[model samples]
Target: MTGFEDEIRRRLLSAQDTGRIEGLLFHSTAEPIVGRLHGDGLDVLWTARDPWVSAQYIPNAGSEILLARPDDWRLKDRVAPTKHDVLYALACEMSGKECCDVEWDWDGRAKSWRVPDGWPTYGDVVGHIEDHYGYVANSNGVYYVRESAGVVMPADWQIEGQVFVALDDGLHFKDVRRSGEPDLTEREYYDGYAFEQAMAQGYDGVIINDHCQADDYGNVPHLSFGLNAIGREKVEWLALPAVRRHLDPWYSGEAILTPDLDEWLADFEMEAVHAL
Candidate 1:
């Protein structure tokens, strides 16, 4: 069960049965695997490209290698695996030690983090330990882990002090703060979030991706993403013909108003078509 050939085959079958086959890369062999790497002539067994990513066992099935068809193993540009992958994180968690240092690229610049001396090894820790400094990317890959003092940024880049979660988000640099002070900070803004800024200031560029949208912050260099709705809770609305203005007492679901209800309103002084 540990490293047996049959066990490996069984595991592969299990993956196929579970319908989790996306990046499957298996080498087929007309002959059957009976023993170790020498017996089967295959040295590698169940290994993952990265810890977080799905585990793709080496192609060793039939005589031909059955890989994920859509998968471009022969493609020119293949993604490289990182050492601080999920396995490293799990190992760190299980061993109670931090693992994997990730690298980052900012504004067409590469950034490296610095680690401290005498750090604990993967063996020293015993269970899942948390590395607070390392940032797990959207791909679940760890990067820029610095045990000494957080991620190492460029000498020219100002330290924002706060930790920013790397997601499909955009940031901006403004020249003023709400307290009417000169703002030299890297501010974050997105679609739904812009509503608050716009309501407060009467203008905003971060949410809409335009000139200074926030009247309070005024016009400034906006470094934001092309995200659709910045800060509002996105809701699914069915677009149907509206009969009148939405008059639902409670905001339960969509209110598709119709313009056919009544075109006349009764007023004490004003005459309507009904009066005529």
Candidate 2:
């Protein structure tokens, strides 16, 4: 095992109270309290006010924290974990690390890889990680999604769900009436739903009434409903004109209405041509 994996083993083995570590990563710092945004007919909503962070006095989940500062890159506010961090955790696992040097770029020359016979390639492993963790804290209904900025009222918010599928080409909507299930990734499902609805209803995108915003590259497709962890009966969908009536009181109760995306705010005029 490489030095990275050794570090993970060291941390895990040296911990006196593993429970504290879990709570620090999983549990809320304080009760995530918020009041509902009352409107005409809003029902349920989840407003993300902050990025999930570890608290000294909070309960933790079983997740581990990997802090790796990669070379030639640094964030002004925060940094994403690196390959070393991932390997470190894997090395300490019950099965130990597999294909430890499959992706080692020791020669400093790009396009060099070592593939073990009959085993899945390094690319496959990397793809899996990218697909899952890329959108760790997003605005999609499930998982950890944060809201965007400029949000104040209920109407200027969103209800993230599986409505459409955004692929390498463009956006494709799932005809819930026609198609039996959503046909895209979890990240795409929520984004596609918003895109199709906005385009169909003659709106630009989900407007932001909150104080958070970012680009669309970080979002992953929303998985199909009623499968895996997304066991909900149906996907969530909220539109611009219908937000106020559907978001209910976000700050109150157990629900909140955080804007899914701010980059979607790009100007796009929608037109209506009825098929009558």
- Tell me, by TM-score, which candidate is best: 2
How many residue pairs collide in each prediction? 45, 46
Query: Which lDDT tens digits does candidate 2 get at residues 1-276?
Result: 334333322332333233121100011122332342211111112222121111111222223232222222222212111344342232222123333343435654323333234333223323333353342322332222222231111212233221111111121222222233323332232344543454466432232222111222222112121111111112222221111112222323312111211112211111112322
For model 2, what is the alpha-carbon lDDT of residue 192?
A: 41
Taking the tens digit of each residue's C-alpha lDDT, what string does model 1 give over 85-137? 43333333444544235366654322543333433333222111223322232
Model 2 lDDT on a 0 to 1 scale: 0.25
The superposed Cα distance between candidate 2 and the true structure at residue 24, in angstroms, equals: 25
Score residue 238 of candidate 2 by CA lDDT: 23
Task: List candidate 1 segments past 4 Å from native.
Answer: 1-119, 123-140, 144-276
TM-score of each: 0.13, 0.18
Model 2 alpha-carbon drift over 4 Å, by segment? 1-57, 66-84, 87-97, 100-115, 118-122, 130-250, 255-276
In angstroms, the error of model 1 at 153 is 12
